[model samples]
Target: MIINKILNVDDYYFDVFMSISESLTGFSVNELQSTGLAEIYYKHILGQIEAATFTEFLNISKNILENSYTQDQLNNAIAAEIFANASTEDIANSIITLWYLGTWEGAYVNDLSYKEGLVWNVMHSHPPGAKQPGYKSWGVKPVNSNI
Candidate 1:
């Protein structure tokens, strides 16, 4: 049987958020060995990103960054805006993580279940050609393996 695939906004937000965060922080996606405050901040940023799609998150983050808020303050502000009505901490955390990831300069496609054909199509459409300098690479692969 063929499995129907539907893209989730939260997943898209997470991918984009990670890309942006890496760009802004100058950290490789796999090299973010964060803990404590950095970890907390990451979570919050992700939350904000997950709460909104790429375009919405970008607009919100741009507005916040242009203001005088510190990184922490900006993160919280984004969380508040994204989770205006939601009360779940998990959702909030996701939003925070999303925001942190969105700071970078690339698109994210974190859906593991996506078909290879579909992923390639999306990647080609967004980037249009070979990978550019300072942008995260996109493709399909396992995050970890024990083979």
Candidate 2:
């Protein structure tokens, strides 16, 4: 008997995270996973829930991970807010900023994933019909190629 393999929820989350990161930053899982910011964000996600709720937590985590923030601006804003007794307005602003940051990051990740996916699709696609003499010549060729 043969056993079929299936991706677990955690695996799926990681896959999605990697895909988004690659799309946004051109970094692979191995490279980005250890980055200081990524690690901090990852720990934040991991610490917020138990194992049983991992799948549900993953959606929110994914959103956070994929969100983008300008390093300089985020650092400045964080520094300013670090010692202040934040008011409701400040808190609201912070939340809004974070949400926007997440969206920006998500878009970057999505764009990179889209670009990589397009490349992959083009590389592995099948023509609608039988292979023709000129079928393989359709893609963008190198300038140096003597086609």
Candidate 3:
């Protein structure tokens, strides 16, 4: 889609985004995409006209990864980049939060699971206001026995 162009980042950038995002959020790239976190992140950045900020963040991060710097140096620099500008910082947090919770920061928690969001999947529960597990399913103890 056009997002592929708007993001316009190289494979290196995507790889880094996936790596650092995984490291920061503890979610696999598959989870991110399956939960629509990636798309939401793109929409959030594009909505804020912060795509350039994201691109710049990725560029800087990739550069750091390619350097002979210490992990502390890389981590510190990336942290600085994210926090250096409030706008980029917001975007950065939004990306991580989206991956973890499957929703935007300002959005209602229920709205996050409006569809088959990651939270519901990970929690083994249905989305709030979407559907119930059936009237007695909640009390059924789930069949697997592991909770």
Candidate 4:
């Protein structure tokens, strides 16, 4: 990938990547970073997409985030600037899917990706057989405070 070829691991690209992901996924940077999959996902995306396309996408996202003052404004800008383009829309969707499902286009990125998926936390559940909610725990309704 061009990013890996040119930029070091500690480059600002990763910070930009995480910020874009936070906007796309509606998850905080801390939450996404806690998954321990940011670098993996960043490299995976760079490998899948052309360098110019990825760079353009990130640049647009950065601009939108910078120019928008409120969260609603930011979201509107992202919708207009990022998701409005076909290629960028696909990349954005892939990013959201990567966060929620830990899969890129239906294929798991890594073994840990599945176990660390955001969907589990969102649903207040664990990946079956991985975390094991406990024997027969499914029989009881989930105690979701938010609900």
Which one is best on lDDT? 4
User: What tens digits encode model 4's per-residue C-alpha lDDT throughout 4-97?
Assistant: 2222466566777888788888888889979889889999988988988889888887777678778899888988988889988998999999
CA lDDT of every candidate: 0.39, 0.37, 0.59, 0.83
| Per-residue accuracy of model 1 over 55-76 as CA lDDT, tens digit each | 5655544454455246576556
- The collision pairs in model 3 are none
Which run of 10 residues does model 4 get worst, by summed lDDT?
Answer: 1-10
Where in model 4 is the C-alpha error above 4 Å? 1-9, 134-141, 144-147
lDDT (C-alpha) at residue 80 in model 4: 90
Q: Give the TM-score of candidate 4.
A: 0.85
- Following a full C-alpha superposition, what root-mean-square deviation does model 4 have from the true structure? 5.1
Writing each residue's lDDT as its tens digit, candidate 2 over 1-147 gives 111122233446555434334333444445444332343333333454354454443443344344425545433443343214344223233222222232222343222223233223324532234333265556756445698
Selected candidate, larger lDDT, 3 vs 4: 4
Q: Model 2 lDDT vs. the true structure?
A: 0.37
Error of 4 at 23 (Å): 1.2
lDDT of 3 by residue, 1-147 (tens): 011222345444566666556545656566665654454455454565456777887766566556525657756766776667786577667766666565666563345445645556667777667767887676778545787
In model 3, the runs with Cα more than 4 Å from the true position are: 1-16, 64-87, 108-113, 116-124, 131-136, 140-147
Clash pairs, model 2 backbone: 23-112, 23-113, 67-102, 67-105, 68-105
Segments of candidate 2 deviating more than 4 angstroms: 1-11, 36-39, 43-147
